[model samples]
Target: MKNRTKIALLLLSSFGLMACDVATNTSPKTDPNTTAQTAVVSEASSSDNVTKEKVETTKAEVVMKAKTTSDGKLILGEQEWVYIPGLKESFKARVDTGATTSSVSAVDIQPFERDGEDWVKFKIEHDGINSDEIELPVERWVKIRQSSAEGTQRRAVVVAWLQMGDYKAQTEFTLADRTHLTFPILLGRSFVNGVAVVDVSQKYIQDKHKE
Candidate 1:
């Protein structure tokens, strides 16, 4: 009778142990494909997070373009631009820091040889305030350095009449088809030298920023 009782207790204990093990092992048995799918999903989630972060960082860096300045002068960069309130049109330009002269855009720079003197005839949009074309006469074609995206460059040039900020300055500019450039007029050292000092790190020094 004691042996029967001992056998019954042993059987019950063995069954309890089996039940505990089964309960502990209840994690759904997964195939290799399921495990791989889980890993892929996790990896894709991580990649998506990283991609979003990169896009946000790039957008933050692309704030409005800052204008160029140096000391008290406004230094124009190679392809900086400014709005002429008088002309009502934006002039894309390549700024030449090395040139002693500045230039404006003109079309049909034709050479008219007379009395062994060389003169270029061109059409100035002239403030572009009026659709009426103004014929501007050139004095001479002088060699000047033109600043470009590449570097400071030398080129043949001519002069034109331009008004900047209540100041009527005789600006010397090469006749350029600057329809493709950023600013239509190249503000060389001659145009900016004694007039205003350039402060390279600032743009639109006259404007206020909203926080």
Candidate 2:
């Protein structure tokens, strides 16, 4: 009777241990499931933060792109004479908003080097016997599309100063053969845009010889 009582107590203790082991295994599974849910919430939060940052960056760029002048600009005529004091030469220019770049008549373009810099020599038409020639260091080169031709032409550009009446500007000019055109100089939008407003009905509104 004593041996049987001892065996019965041992069996009851083993059953209790088995129940504890089962509970421990089930508790570990629940912890991993909770961790997975937390990781998913964290990943979702990070994605939302990235989207908000992009929205703020785009808004800043939009604000930067929207720019305007505070003061008004000069109103100019369609036709004006631009005088260059350095050359003592004046050119009749057609203020054209259609063209993006300004053009000047130049013939016999010869590339030369001066002071280890690239220079260009071109002749300008005048009422004088000798072909009046000008030489300057090449500022840059531009590829332009011509209305009279099919393909584009690469022309040499230079920076020069010009006077119209009260307005004076240092602008870029591209050299080209403009003998076939009525005006020797075509003052494009690059020279007049934002600074002057052109009236097509007006002519010589500003004088170069007005001193």
Candidate 3:
């Protein structure tokens, strides 16, 4: 009887070991494809984050560059507020790259001789407002062909100090009647050359002149 009991105990032990082995073998195993897919998703997410950071950095740089120039010149827009020292007031000015010479609104323009030098007297008039009579030495005279008229009209040019933003310089301006024009002053390439760059799409890019 003792021998038979020992044999039955051994048989039970063997069966238990086999069952454990079967359970271990049948247990759910990790799918290699699923692990690979997870790794790929993680890498893609990391790559997307890096791309977003780069894009944001590029956009910020573009914005900063738009407000400034690489050559340390003012960035002018289609229109700007220019301060004329002679008039002691700021006026709206049109920035025209197509024009070769600047012009200012003037009326009662008369040319005379002063101390044996050519001089001109005029009053700035625009938009129903008129300035005091100002006399300046004539720098030169130019005849501009009118788009509406068949003949050319003569105008006197004078050197005037003008301030736009932080830039101040003396430039030549042709005296002409501009009461019907939108802006009293027209800035041309002569004024903008080496002083600023024109961005026709923008307006008032520079701060208004003060004092």
| Index of the highest-lDDT prediction | 3
Ranking by TM-score: 3, 2, 1
Best by TM-score: 3
Model 1 RMSD in Å is 11.5
Q: Against the hidden true structure, what lDDT does model 3 obtain?
A: 0.90
Task: Give lDDT tens digits, candidate 1, residues 1-211.
Answer: 9999999999999999999999998997779998999999999999999999999888766533322333334434345444443344444444566765666666655666566766666554444422224334455555434464555443336555554333344566667655455455777787777665555554433322111
Instruction: Give the clash total for candidate 3.
Output: 0
* Candidate 2 per-residue lDDT over residues 110-177, each given as its tens digit: 98899999899987663331246788889998888879789998889987788877567788888888
lDDT of 2 at 132: 67
The per-residue C-alpha lDDT of model 1 at residue 163 equals: 41
Off by over 4 Å in 2: 1-72, 126-131, 147-150
Each candidate structure's TM-score, on Cα atoms with residue i matched to residue i, is 0.42, 0.59, 0.69
Q: Per-residue lDDT tens digits of candidate 3, residues 1-33?
A: 999999999999999999999988896889999
Error of 1 at 121 (Å): 2.4
Give RMSD (Å) of candidate 3 vs. truth: 6.7
